[model samples]
Structures are given as structure tokens and as C-alpha cells.
Target: MVYTAPGSAAFSRKRGSMADKITAELALIDTELAAVELGDIELNSGEILVGNAGNVATAVTPSGDVTVSNAGVTTIGAKKVGKAMLVSESEAVAGNIFVSTGADSAIDEVAVSGDATLAASGALTIADSVLDGSNVANTSPDNVIGAIPVLYRIAVEDASANNDITSTHKFLVTDFWFVGGATPGVAEDTVQLLNGTNAISEAVAKTTDANCLVRATQLNQSTGMIAAGGTIRITSVKNTNVAGTAYVMGIRVA
Candidate 1:
């Protein structure tokens, strides 16, 4: 039988059979329910299976923040939210964070709040960089400032030439020494300064000793002997010794 809508309650009660048929036919319309309100709702398994937006289980509040519990995967406003973490075991992190589990790891820019301590497996080098510090500690080999100019040691010995009174023999001077002798009689076993060789103002010579002796000379620029490139030769004039020694100590000014 066909049912007609009327405003009066009597019509509804009288058409009770028609109403039952109408309700059955309209069951599909009820599936498209608008909103639901409930004190609490619990689902028993197998009773309801929620489809995509086919059904909306929960909705956002007016505040725009969402909280979920025990969800394996969820999404909010296009951002995927996972349960605990987003883990990448095989994939790599490009852009800023680059991590190589096996070989190399590098970060483009890193900022630490306090001091930074770096530990390296191999040698760590900060090349072509200036370290601003008042003092520097050198823990390597020998530290060299500048070159020092100094005569180590000198020695003197007998002359190699035979009776060469007028000629001068090249005596290997071990250290700075002097000897002297009388006029023309093998000179004198004396410690006297040579014309251009002796650095001391007065020539020093030993009148009697055959052994070599040292002559003190000023360690300054005024003393022509032992200057920068100047060589001081020890000559055995009256003394037979042709070997002597001289030690020089000076700093490199230039």
C-alpha cells in the first residue's frame, strides 16, 4: 500500500504498517548519517569496518591540534604522523644531514652551544688557517726561530812549509792562539795579533811557548776578523806551529 504524509499524529499511528515498509525502504538513507554524538562509543571487532572517508571515525576540535593514541599510522593536514619514530635503516639523508654508517659522515653546518671537541681516527689538520693566540705550544720536532751565527771552536798547528820566513803557510787553526819569537830568529813564540787577522787592538804573542794559545777578540762589527763572511786565519810566523784554533759566537742580525 502507498503511504501519504500528513501532519497529524493520528495519520502516523493509523498508517503503522505503511510506516514499517517506509522505514525499511529508507534504510540506505540512514547509512549516510550526518554527525554522531555520544557519551562514549566502543567498537567490538568485526562489528564495524571503517572505510576511507566513507566513514569518519574522529574529527578535529575547534582548537586545530590533534592527539592520537596507539595508532600505527595517521595523517594530519598532509603531514604523516607515525607511532613512535620515522626510521631509515637503508636510505640516506641528503641535503644538510649526511650520515654514512660504514665510511664517512659529514654535516654541512653544525652549531654547538658551548665548546666543540673533535676526535679523529687519523690526523686532523686545519690548513691555511690562522690561529689567534698569544702563545703557541709546539709539540713536534725542533722549533727554529732564526739562524744563529757563532764560531764553534778553533785550533792551531805547525806550518807545513819548510823555513818559509817571508811566505805564509796555511796553518789549520784549531782554536784562536798566539806565539812569538825574537827578530829573525824564528820570530818569537808569542801571542800577537796579525795585521788584519787579530781582532784584539794590541797583538798578543807568546814569546817562549811552542804550544798554541788563545787570543781574546771583541765580538762586534768593529773587529774585522770573524765578521759576517770574513775568515780569520791563524799564522805561525816565528813559531814553527802551523795549526791553531778559533771559536766564534755571534747572532745573525741580517
Candidate 2:
């Protein structure tokens, strides 16, 4: 072509055509933008439009595991767990729970009318028991004879004439046993067992070997040997006659 000035008829006509093309393109862009702004875009279910950091929304179709984050208060009617599972803060009331075998393991409420039997493969530990034969099996809640509670064990070398043995706590003496030094088979030592001022078992012969004397005859019977906070004073007839260490073991029931 040929060069022409800006005010020329040919130049003005070409410039007008270019301006028309630009105006038409801009109008088409405006129409498309209006459609988008009106939310005219359609999507299938589960498809979503995500916004970027620039706040521009782009259509995205997620596959595999779609993470739902920052959603508050999700509720489910029922959930099934397969294989091993862990959960926190589970609670069970006084109701029956059944495994696949249909056996019911029920927890009853606190006892008001009758006794409740607790049976389990594990131990049933009772912190406090008001248990009795009516509630517990093979339970002698009142019997203390079967229980051996050692109140005090006194050891002395050649106990003096008025050797006194004191106990911190009072106990009901079931039986008193003493091991003293003596010639085997030679009964030479004699000891008196006294409860405070009274002699419970007097002239009790102790040999070189072990001597177990049951003071059932001397016991108060209504109460055991001695009341709580009571003491027993053991006296030796001849201190030099008793050769070895005199160990006095007192057995009692709590």
C-alpha cells in the first residue's frame, strides 16, 4: 500500500473500521461478564467452585477423598466401624449390653430393696462393704478368729523379774507363744502373762524350745484377752535360769 495522512478520507475510513471491531469485542465481553455475574453457570451435584487467595472462584471437580475442613457441628445418626477402632468418653447406664452370643451383661442401679450379685471374669473390688451371707458367698463378716493379726512381738535377753511388754494398740489376745533359751527337754523357765494388774496366764512353763500357750481359759470370753489400749506384763521367775533370748509373739484377731 500507499502512505496516507491522518485527515485523509482513506485513513479516516480505515480507522473507523478498527474502532468498530474494538467496540464489538468489548460489547461481547460485557455480555459474557453479565451472564457470569448473574450465576448462570450450571454444575453437576458434588461439583464446587473454590476461591483462591486472590478471591477468584474457579470450578473444581474433586475425586478420591474430599476433605471437609472447618465445618462446625457435624452430626451423624449412626456410624458403623469395621476392624479395630478407638473412641473416647463412652458411657453406659444401668442397661444390658449383648455381644454376638446374645448374652446380656446388665448393671443394676444401687441397692435399695434387695442385694445385688456382681459376677464377672475379673475381680469385683468392694471399696466399702456392708456385705453379709445374704449378699456375699462364704463370707463370715463377723468372724475374726480365722484372721491372724500380730499386735506385737517382744524380744528380750533374759527377761527381768518384772519384765513388762507393752503394745501400742489394744488387741484381743487369741494365743501367746514364746521361744526361750533352755536345755532341750529341760523345762526350767517360768513366765507369768499379766493383763495390766491381773494375771491372765500365770506359771506358764517355757522350755529351751518353742512354747505355744493358748489362753482361752483366761480370756474375758465376753471380750477376748484384753481390751483395746491394754497391755500385758510378762514376769520371769528367775532371769539367770533363762539362758537365751526370750522372744514373745502375741497373736490376736482384729
Candidate 3:
């Protein structure tokens, strides 16, 4: 057996053996380092390193609408988010709206199916008569003819007989008409209107001299504006002369 000093060949051999073991261990470390080398990594600009299984590092290179920097800074591209990403665009239209049919579901259009519909020309129309006078919910007038005065219709039968005609109610005399039946009142015969006894009209003519059929409007009111319980008296110069049928037309005052 040879005794070897610290600097001797045997001692150097022992050191070499330890160095060989260290080199073998270092080889494994070098292999692992080579597997994760910067050259092996395919990271471009805007990339971040991510650890895989068993501590294997991988380069996460942002693509498409996003990017990552070598410093691990990340950014997303602009205008990449479109309507298709947000909604199911199969039902999209110009005037249509996005309507969610169910909760937690994607929204789309149901434009024409609703009460109102829109045309392709951007003209919106209500379905059928949905917005007409009948369907519209509103406080309508109980009487549609608001504030319009009613037409006072005098019955033709009431003024048929030619005599002292007394009105059934208080009346405002407006017009008078006459048609000869066998014996018509003469043209000069004055058909006077009276409120009880006081005369309201000067002389309402029964008929014209040329013809028995006569119509006159706005009879003169002498006594006052109107007559209550008025009487249509045939006052003739020749009294007791026969007179035919006549109509006293007026509005009810009372």
C-alpha cells in the first residue's frame, strides 16, 4: 500500500473521483437547465413564463387579440370584441332590439312577433289596430261630443194645425214654415208669436203672396229674447179667416 500525500497522485486520484461524481451530478443539472434554456424557449415580445408539471417552465406567448411582454407585462388588442362575441347575431336587425327570452340566457330579437313591428326601411308599424282608438288605454270622454250644443229638433206634427198653437214648454222661437192645406193663410196675414199674452214677434208671415208654401228664419222677438210657454197665434187683419197647416220651429229655452 502506498501512502499518498495531499498533493500526491493517489490523493489527486481521490479528488478526481469526487470531481467525477460532482460532474455527473452537474450533468443532470445542466440537462435540466438546457431543457429550460432561453434558446429553447419560443417566447417573442409580450410573453410570460409559466411553470408546467414537474416544474417545467413554458413560454406563454400571447397571440390573436392579446399580447404579453418579455417583462411579463400583458395587453389585449383593441376592437377585437365584436357583437358576435356578445350576442347571438342570427336575429339581429336594424330596428330590432336584443331581447332575453329567458333568464341567464343569450339575448336576441323578437321584433315582428311583438305588438309593434319595424320594416326594413326603418318604418315602425303597430300590429293591426293595436294603437287605435279602442285599444289605447286612456281616460276617454264619457260624452265624445264635448261642449257641443245639441240640435233642438222640433217635431213636424206639433205644428200641423193652424190655430192658436200653445207650446208645451218654454221656447225660443227661431223659424216658421207653412204649407197650404185646402185653406192657407193669406200672405198679408201676420202669424204673431206671443209669450202668454205679450207679443214677442212683430209679424211672422204664414206664406208669401205668390205661393202658400213659405219658410222664414229668425222671427223678430219684440217683447224679450224668448218666450216661456209661447203661443203661436194667427193674427190676421181679416179675423176668422181659415188658415192651413204651419210649423213653429224653435229651441227649448227652459
Q: In TM-score terms, which candidate is top? A: 2
> How many residue pairs clash in all the candidates, one count each?
54, 2, 5
Residue 122 displacement (Å), model 2? 16
| lDDT at residue 42 of model 2 (Cα atoms) | 74
Q: lDDT (CA) for every model shown?
A: 0.35, 0.47, 0.52
**Predicted candidate 2 versus true structure: per-residue lDDT over 38-156, tens digit per residue:** 24667554456889788998766554423222232333323433222322224322222223433465333332222333333333445455642123222132675454445344543
User: How much is the lDDT of residue 20 in candidate 1?
Assistant: 79
- The estimated TM-scores of all candidates read 0.26, 0.35, 0.29
List residue ranges in candidate 3 displaced over 4 A.
Answer: 1-162, 183-186, 204-211, 222-230, 239-242
Q: Give candidate 1 regions above 4 Å deviation.
A: 1-149, 160-187, 190-201, 207-213, 217-221, 225-228, 240-242
Worst 10 residues of 3 by lDDT: 149-158
**Against the true structure, what is every candidate's RMSD?**
19.7, 17.9, 19.5
Model 2 RMSD to the real structure?
17.9
Candidate 1 lDDT tens digits, 1-254: 23334455654555458867568546534643323334235544223324547576544322233433333233353454342234353442222232344535522322222233223333333434343211232221122563323333434334432111111211222123332222221334333223244443233444334443446453223453333234444344435433433332333232
